[model samples]
Target: MPGSGANKTHAVVEGGSIFIQKLNSSLWAEANEKKILLGQLISMYSELLKTIFKNKRSKHVKDIIAALEVYKTHYSDGMKKAEELLQLAKLPMNDAKIELKAIMELRTVLLEMNKEEVRRKRRSRAQNPRGRPNLSG
Candidate 1:
C-alpha cells in the first residue's frame, strides 16, 4: 500500500501520454519499493478472501467471491512481474529496451488495478449515496 494514495491520485488525473509517462517514471524510480508494496497487497487480498468465505450465506456471496478471486489473481501476477523486474534491475549489463519493456508491463498492471479501484468506488457510491437510501417510496 506504499503508493496506494498516489495511484488513486494518478487515476483521477485527466491528461495525455505525458502525464502517464511521468507516473511511469515515478514508479520506475521506486520500483523495488513498489515490488514490496505489491507483495503486501497480495497478502492483504488473500486475507480478504478468507474473511469473505467465512460468511458463507451472505447475499451476493458468490459475486463477491468471484470478484475477490479476480483481484487476487491480478495482485499475484503483479507480484511475479515486479519480482522479475527487480531481478532484471540487478543484472550486470541489462538491455535498456528489455528493462523499459518490463517497466511498462508492470505499469500496465498498476494502471489496471487503479481502474478497478475507481470502478469499485463508483459502484459503491451509486449503491448508497449519502450512506443510506430513502425509505419512503
Candidate 2:
C-alpha cells in the first residue's frame, strides 16, 4: 500500500497495459474468478486459524497453517514476484538500475503485516487454561 500504485500503473502502461487486453474472454473471466477465490481462501484460512486458537484446538492447526503457507508462497508470492519482474522488464532500467521503490515499500508493508499477524495470533491465544496473561481481557 505504500507504493502509491503509481509504479504499478506506470508499469502497466509501459507493459502495454494488459489489464484490458483480451486474452479470450472466458479464460480471462476464469482467471479473475480464481484470483478472487484465492482471496477468499486467505480469508477463510485466517478465520479458521482464529477459531482453532480460540477453541484451543491444536490437533490440526499445523496442517492448516502449513497449507496456508504453501498457498501464499505458490499462489500469492508467485503472482507478486511475476508482477515485479514484468514491471522491471517493461521499464527501461539503465544498467540494471531499476528503481524498486515500489517493491521495497511493499516488502515493508508485508513485514509489518506479518508482525501484526503474529501479535494477533498470540493475543488470540493468550488466555490459556493455565494462568497466563489474557490479552483479550
Candidate 3:
C-alpha cells in the first residue's frame, strides 16, 4: 500500500479530466474490464508469492517462483509501462522537442516488452503443447 495514496490522487485527477471528443462507451467498458482483470492477477500473484516463500526451501517451489518472476517481467511490467506511455502521450505538448524524445523512449520500452511477452508465450506453449492448466476449477 506504499503507493495507494498516490493512486487515489491520480484517480481523482484522471476522473476529473475534460475531454474534447466524446468517449466511446464500448472502449471504456473494455478498459474497465481489463483493469479489473489486471488487479485480480496482481492480487493472486502476490498471494501465490507469499505462499511460495513459506516453502522456499523446496526445489519445486523455487522453480514456480522463477516462472512467476518471468511472468511478472513480461506481463505486469509490460502493462504498467504501456499504461505510463499512454498517459505521457495524452499530455498536452508544451515542448514538442522534449515530449517527442520521451515518447520515443517510452515507445521503445513498450515495444521491447511486447516482444519479450510474445517470446515467453511461444516458449511456454512449446513446453506445454496442451496449453496452460485450468486454474478456475
Candidate 4:
C-alpha cells in the first residue's frame, strides 16, 4: 500500500538522469581519492626502499619499487583521463557511455593496484612471521 507507492517513487528517481549524474559524480570522487592514495603509497614505498638500500640492499625490493613507480604513473594518467571524460560527459550530448567507460578504466586501475597491494602484503607477511611492524608502538 503506502510502501508500494514509495517503492514506485524510488524507482522513478533511480531511473532519471539526476540519479545517473549523481552516481557518476560519486565515481569521479572515488577515482580522485584512489589517485591520492596511490601517490601516498608510492611515496611510502620509495621511503622504505631508501631505508633498505641504506642498510642492506636487495634486488627484490628495488624491483618492487620500480613497479610501484610505474603503477603510480599509470594511475595518475588514468585520473587525468577520467577528468577529461567527466568534462565530456557534461556536454549537451550528455553521453553516459563516456562516463561509464571512464569509470570502468579507473576501476580496472584500482583493481590492479589492489591486487599488487595484496601481493606485497603477502610477501611482507611471509618474510616476517611476526606480522607487520607496529607503528603505534
Candidate 5:
C-alpha cells in the first residue's frame, strides 16, 4: 500500500519502453525494463486469492476468482500480445496501427485514468486552493 494514494501516470517512451511517473513526486521508472517473472506473478496472485478467501463477502468474489483462473489459460496469448505491442511501439505512429487493438485499448484505459486523475486534482484545488486547512477559529 506504499502507493495507495499516489497517482501514477504511465507512458510509452522512446525505444518502445514503458515508463511510470508518480504525480507530485520525483518517483519515475521505465516499467518495461524490468521483466516480471512468473514467480513474482504467482506470489501476487496467491496473495489475492488469500485476500478473496478471507473476504468472501467482497462484491463479485466468485467472478473475480473465476477470472483469475481463466487468466492462467490465456497466459501465452497475453505474452504474445505484449510482444506485439513492444514491436509496434518501435515503428512510426502511422505504420503502427495494424493488429494493435489490445495496445490501443490499453492506451485508452491509461488516458481515461489520467483524465480522471486530472479532474480529481482540479476538484481538490477548487475545494482547497491553499492545499491546507484554513485553521481559522
Candidate 6:
C-alpha cells in the first residue's frame, strides 16, 4: 500500500522526463560491467585449473575430485549471486551469467578446501591425538 509519502515520491519521479530514467538505467549498466569482469576472473581461474591438471591424471584424481566438488558448490553459489544481482539491479537477467560462473568456480575451490581440510585433520589426529604428554606432569 502506498502511503501519502509514496504518492509524493512517484510524483517527483514522474516529473522528470528523460534524465531520471536514464540515470536509473545507467546505474545498472555500471553494475553489469563489474559483474562481467568478475566472470572473466572466474574464466581465468578455470583455465588455470586446466593447465594444472592438463597432463597428470591418475595421481591427482582425488585432488581433482575434491576440486570439482568445490566447483559444484561455487557454481551453485554463483547462480545465487546472479539471482541476487538481478533482484538488486532490477535489470534483465542476461548480463549476469559470467558473474554467476565465477561465483560457482569459487564454490568449487571452497569444496576442495573443505575436503582437503577434512582429510588433513583426520591424518593429524591419527598421528597425534593426545599431544606430547604435558611436560610438567
Best by lDDT: 4
Question: Over the stretch 14-131, how does candidate 3's per-residue lDDT look in tens digits?
Answer: 8874331223334434554455445446546656776858755477767766776666554665466556767978877778987788787997889999999999899878777787
Where in model 3 is the C-alpha error above 4 Å?
Answer: 1-43, 77-137
Model 6, range 21-125, lDDT digits (tens) per residue? 543564436554444434434545556666767787565764765565566555555545666767868744466985687677888889999999999899767
Residues 1-137, candidate 4, lDDT per residue (tens digit)? 66697898998787876433643564446655656545555656677787768777688877887887787676766556556767967765456876677677897889999999999899878777687675653
User: Where does candidate 4 clash, by residue pair?
Assistant: none
Model 2: lowest-lDDT 10 consecutive positions: 17-26
Local error of candidate 6 at residue 90 (angstroms): 33
**Per-candidate TM-score against the hidden true structure:** 0.27, 0.29, 0.27, 0.31, 0.24, 0.24
C-alpha RMSD for every candidate: 18.0, 22.7, 15.0, 20.9, 16.0, 22.3
Q: Against the unseen true structure, what C-alpha lDDT does each candidate score? A: 0.67, 0.64, 0.65, 0.69, 0.55, 0.62
Q: How many clashing residue pairs, candidate 3?
A: 0
Q: Give the range of the ten consecutive residues with the poorest summed lDDT in model 3.
A: 19-28
Q: In model 3, how large is the Cα lDDT of residue 22?
A: 22
Candidate 1, residue 59: Cα displacement in angstroms equals 3.6
In terms of lDDT, the poorest run of 10 residues in model 6 is 18-27
Model 3 / residue 62 / CA error / Å: 0.9
lDDT head-to-head 1 vs 3, winner? 1
Candidate 6: stretches off by over 4 Å: 1-99, 133-137
Task: Report the error of model 4 at residue 103, Å.
Answer: 35
Best by TM-score: 4
> lDDT value for candidate 6?
0.62
Candidate 2 C-alpha lDDT tens digits along 1-137: 65778987887778883433543335436564556446445646766787758756575886777677777665775456546757867886453444465555788889999999998778667646466766674
Candidate 1 wrongly placed segments (more than 4 Å): 1-43, 52-57, 82-137
